[model samples]
Structures are given as structure tokens and as C-alpha cells.
Target: MIALSDTVSASSDLLSTEIDGEVVMMDMEAGRYLYLDRIGSVIWSELKRPQTVADLCQSLADRYAAPIEQIECDVLDLLQQMRRNDLIRLHD
Candidate 1:
């Protein structure tokens, strides 16, 4: 399981493109395509550089003017989905 202390980054192998404030990514290895909304796109952009999950939640909370707890919950869910899709890499 992923923890807030863990570091995460986008998988470098994906082929992605941005359009209308959203992002579309192709996981070639998985033979699948994924679409991200504006908020997801922001998260995806930030994940271009590896960062701790706690830090990412704080940053997003600030940007979206939301509570850290809520942000953390949403981010954790999204991160898990991304991980399952092999769209992200996690570090201890």
C-alpha cells in the first residue's frame, strides 16, 4: 500500500498529450488509454517530478483551497488508480 511518506512520479514510458485543459495518456505496455480531467492533469504534471505524497497533498490543498484531509483522501484514491494502471512509479 502507498503511504504519505512515499515518493511518486509519472511513468516515463507513457505517451501523453494535453488538450482542452485535460490530459490523455497511452500506456503502451498495457495497451490502454487513460484520460485525465483538469485536476488530474494538474496532479499528473506535478508527478513529472518525484515528490512525497504528503507534500503533494499539501500543494494540492493550497492550490484548490480545500482541506488537507479531503485533498489527501482524493489524492490517495487517484494515486492508487494510477498505480494500478502502471501510470506512476512509487519509491520508498
Candidate 2:
């Protein structure tokens, strides 16, 4: 499970490209490709370096005028999905 303090980073074997504001990622190890929309693209960009879930929430909250609770929920959901897909790594 992803905690607020847990730091997340992109998997080393993944390569990403942005096309018209969206992101396309290739996982070399998994031999799969994934796509992200505008918001997911932002999340992908942030994960280039290790960052805590709290930092991600705050950064997203700053960009969008949404409630922190909602942003937190959405971010957590996305992170969990990414984790399942082996697109990101979580640090304890």
C-alpha cells in the first residue's frame, strides 16, 4: 500500500514521450506500452525523481484548485494502479 510519506519513482527501464500534452510510456522490461492523459502526464513527470505522496498531493493541489482530500484520493488511486502495472517503484 502507498502511504503519504512513501516516496515513489519511475521504474528505471521505462522510457516516456509526450505527444500533444499526453504521455506515452514504454516499459522495456515488461515489453509493454502505456498512455497517460494530461493529468496522468503531470503525475508521470513528477515521478521522474523520487517524491513523497504528500509532495505529489501538494503540487497537484497547487496546480488545480481542488480539495486536498479529493486530490489525495485520486493520486493514491493512480499510484496504486501504476504500481500494479510495474510503472513505478515505491520506497518505504
Candidate 3:
């Protein structure tokens, strides 16, 4: 699934996330939370859009001037890691 999780509602626990920014955790499970860089932040925003992977990759490629194939690979790897870390959830 290219999309992060359109049906998986965003948790309020994650204060906010932005490109070139970070994800704040008010009630963090573990203190000193994980941080994301500019590229990760961009992917987070695209996922926030509730867009499918296809759309997200296309958008990322366009925004960053990268090849779609490369972006797709990045997205898959990052998303899998995020999912494993419970940083994100898939719709199903």
C-alpha cells in the first residue's frame, strides 16, 4: 500500500510534524523521541494528505526532482521501518 493509512486516524499524541521540522510527542512512550529530517518530514506530510503510495511517490518525485523509481524505493523502505517502529500505521 502506497498510502500511509487513510483510515488510520492520526493520533493527537503526535503534536505536529512539518517538512524540515520534527514530530513532537506530548505523551511519548519513550522519552527523547525519534526525529525526522527534511526528506522524512516531506514523506510524513504526503502521508498526512491520505494519498496512496502511488500518489505520494509522484508528489515526492515532483517536489524533490527525483526519479519516481528511486522515490518509490525510498518510500517503501522508510514506510516499512516506520511501520515496524509503530511510528505509522497502514490502512490494511
Candidate 4:
């Protein structure tokens, strides 16, 4: 399971591009394409460098008006999905 203390970063194996304010990524190893909305794109950009889950939530909370708890939940869900797709790596 992912925790707020865990560090996350984008996988080095992805080739991604931005279009129409969204992001499209291709996982080279998996040969799969993934789409990310604006918010997801923001998260992806932030993951260029490893960031703690708590730091990610705090960053999102600053940029968005959502509550910290909601941001945390949403970030966790998205990160989980990203992990499953091999788009991100987690470092405990």
C-alpha cells in the first residue's frame, strides 16, 4: 500500500506528450498508451522528481481549492492507478 511518507516518481520508461491541455503517455515496455487529464498532467509533471505523497498532496492543496483530505484521497487513488499501469515508481 502507498502511504503519505512514500516517495513517487514517473517511470523512466515512458514516452509522453501533451495535447489539448492533457497528456498522453506510452509505456514502452508494456506497449500501452495512457491518457491523463489536466490534473493528472499536473501530477505527472510534478513527478519528474521524486516527491513524498504528503508533499504531493500539499502541493495540490495549494494549487486547488479542495480540502487536504480530499486531495490526499484523490492523489492516492490516481497514484495507485498510475502504479498499476507502471507509469510511476514508488520508493518507501
Full-model lDDT for every candidate: 0.93, 0.92, 0.62, 0.93
lDDT of 3 by residue, 12-92 (tens): 345554433755433366454666777877676666644466777777888887788888889878877766656665564
What are the RMSD figures for all models against the true structure? Answer: 0.8, 1.0, 3.6, 0.8
Q: Mind sharing the TM-score for model 4?
A: 0.95
Q: What value does the lDDT take at residue 52 in candidate 3?
A: 65
lDDT of 1 at 57: 94
Model 1 weakest lDDT span, ten residues long? 58-67
In candidate 1, position 61 carries an lDDT of 82
lDDT of 2 by residue, 14-87 (tens): 88899999999888877889999999999999999999999999999999999999999999999999999998
In model 3, the number of clashes is: 2
Which residue runs of candidate 1 sit more than 4 Å off their true CA positions? none
Worst 10-residue stretch by lDDT in candidate 4?
25-34
What overall lDDT, based on C-alpha atoms, would model 2 receive against the true structure?
Answer: 0.92
Going through the candidates in the order shown, the clash numbers are: 0, 0, 2, 0
TM-score of 1: 0.96
TM of each candidate vs. truth: 0.96, 0.94, 0.71, 0.95
